[model samples]
Each structure stands twice: as C-alpha cells, then as structure tokens.
Target: MGLGDFADKAKDAVNSDKGEEVSDNAFDKGSDKLNDATGGKFEDQIDKGKDAADDHVGNE
Candidate 1:
C-alpha cells in the first residue's frame, strides 16, 4: 500500500487501546450515515460492518 496507508496502520497499532473507541466510533458514524442515507436498507449489516472495520483497525 501507499505510505499514508502504512502510516495510518502504524498509528492505529500504536494507539490501539484508545484507538479502539476512535475506530469504532468512526465505523459507527459511517454506518449510521449510510443507514440514514439508505433509509435502513443496510441496517442488518451495520453492526457487522462496524465490528469488522474496528477489528481491521486494531489488527495491525
């Protein structure tokens, strides 16, 4: 991947404890925005998506 992506991945790894919430909140916000925009069509996948997103962030 690109340097920016690598930098972000490293940052997230180093900041994982605090970053967990940060990542989760970001994922949740994105999910909420998408769900709201789509009128709940994606509601079922929101939680799983958020969890997967957050896991990826924390996985390093």
Candidate 2:
C-alpha cells in the first residue's frame, strides 16, 4: 500500500528467511509502488525489482 507498509511486510518476510515464498508478493506489491512513484517509468523493470528484493531478503 505504501513504503511504510511495504517495509513492515518486508521486515517480517526477510526475518522469516523464506526467500522464495515471499519473493513474489514482495515484488508485486513493492513493484507497484515503485511504478506509481516513478510514473509508470519503472513498469519495464518488475523483474529487476523482484530480483533485488529477493536478493536483499534472501541475504538476511
């Protein structure tokens, strides 16, 4: 819904260490925010966003 919400979700997800499970949800939710913030310019990069979020959470 927002950055704060996303962060909260991510925190829990990352802490759980279930990288693959949370990856799609985090990517879809966060990527929507990113796309909205960037005025649709980031629509072409959902995969990158997903991968980045996956890597970040996976590392935790």
Candidate 3:
C-alpha cells in the first residue's frame, strides 16, 4: 500500500531462499554477459561484489 510497506514486502521476498536462488541466477547471467562483452576483464571483480551482496543478504 505505502512505500514502506512495499519496501518491506520486497525485502522479505528477497531474503527468502527462492528469492536468493533467483537473484543469484540473474546476477550470474548478467555478469556472464558483461564479462563476455569485456573479454573477462572484470569478471573476478564483479563476482566479488555479487558475493558481498549475497553475504549481506544472507546475514539478514
């Protein structure tokens, strides 16, 4: 209904197991595309950032 409520629901969804799987898959696919376009120049760095995000979400 409200912005806060919407944000809360989104946060809850993203913190769920299914949501994590979906998020990781999406991020990996996108990262792969970017890495391909850049000839793998930033793949490792991209992975590190994604991993950090996953760690933060998992901790929550």
Candidate 4:
C-alpha cells in the first residue's frame, strides 16, 4: 500500500475502541517515563503534550 493508504488505515485503527485503549496506555506509560526521567520537572508540559496527542488520535 502507498503511504497515504497506510496513514488512512492507521487513522481508522486509532479511531477504534481497542486502538484508543492502546493509545491511552502508551501515552500514560510514555508520559510517566518522561516525568520520571525529568524528576517531574516538566510534568505540566509533558501532560499537556500527552493530552494533545490523545485528542489528535481521537482518544476521548
């Protein structure tokens, strides 16, 4: 498949219930890791970024 087709499929998958769950878990883990690595120094920024990402992927 072409890049556009792949992207469309990916978008569809991410809009599914299972995909939203998976995406939420991944975002939580990744944000937690970043917070830990930075000693929570940038927790606010990281959370904002995480929220934006979740919204972009239609998680909520």
Candidate 5:
C-alpha cells in the first residue's frame, strides 16, 4: 500500500476500540443529513456511497 493508505489503516486500528456501533451511527446520521439537504434526490447514491465509505473506514 502507499504511505497514505498505511496511515489510514493505522488510524482505523487505533479508532477501532471505539466500537462498531458508534461508527455506524455516525455514518448514518451524516447520510441522513445529506439526504435531507438534497431533498432525497440523491438518496440512493448517497446511501450507497455512505455504505462504501463505512466499509472502507472499518465501520463494517
């Protein structure tokens, strides 16, 4: 992996102790806000993008 990817993995490890539920909730809240702001026009894409991000960030 590149240096940035390594750094991100390290950060994820450190924050993993916070527990998965916390991470999931935070992402859900952010997604909700984005959907609300956009009037649900991009709801599906936003949800999918959020899921992908959460997966990458070690939330799932």
Candidate 6:
C-alpha cells in the first residue's frame, strides 16, 4: 500500500473502540511521564495537548 492507504488504515483502526482504549492508555502514560520529567510544571499544557490529541483521534 501507498502512504495514503496506510494512513487511512491507521485512522480507521484508531477510530475503533479497542484502538481508542489503547490510545487513551498510551496518552495517559505519556502525559504522566512528561509531568514527572517536568516536575508538574507544565501539567496544564500537557493535559491540553492530550485533549487535543484525543479530539484528533476521535476519542469522543
């Protein structure tokens, strides 16, 4: 498959229930790591980013 085809398949997978669960878990873990690394100084921004990512991935 070409790049566009691969992207479409990935998007489809991410829009599924199981994929959303995995995506949320990954985002939570990543956000926690970033918060820890930054001593929670950028927690708000991190959360905003996570929200935006979730919206992009059609989590809700």
Give TM-scores for every candidate, taking all chains together and pairing residue i with residue i. 0.63, 0.43, 0.77, 0.82, 0.65, 0.82
Q: Residue 25 deviation, candidate 1, in Å? A: 0.8
| Model 1 lDDT, residue 42, Cα | 77
lDDT of each: 0.77, 0.73, 0.81, 0.92, 0.82, 0.90
Provide the clash count, candidate 4. 0
Candidate 3, RMSD to the unseen true structure? 1.8
Prediction 3 global C-alpha lDDT: 0.81
Better of 1 and 6 by lDDT: 6
Candidate 2, 53: how far from true, in Å? 5.8
Model 5 per-residue lDDT tens digits across residues 1-60: 899999888777646857466777888999999999999999999999998877766533
Q: Candidate 2 or 5, higher lDDT?
A: 5
Cα deviation at 20, candidate 2, in Å, is 2.6
Query: Model 2: which ten-residue window has the lowest total lDDT?
Result: 15-24
| Root mean square deviation (Cα) for candidate 1 | 4.2
Q: Pairing residues by index, what is the TM-score of model 6?
A: 0.82
Model 2, 1-60: lDDT tens digits are: 999999988777666747556665767788888888889876878758677766766435
Q: Go through the candidates in order and give the clash count of each.
A: 0, 0, 0, 0, 0, 0
**Could you tell me the TM-score of candidate 5?**
0.65
Q: lDDT tens string, model 4, 1-60?
A: 999999989888888899999999999999999999999999999999999999888544
TM-score-better candidate, 1 vs 2? 1
Q: List the residue pairs that clash in candidate 1.
A: none
lDDT of 3 by residue, 8-32 (tens): 9998998888888888787778778
Q: Tally clashing residue pairs in candidate 2.
A: 0
Residue 22 displacement in candidate 5 (angstroms): 1.4
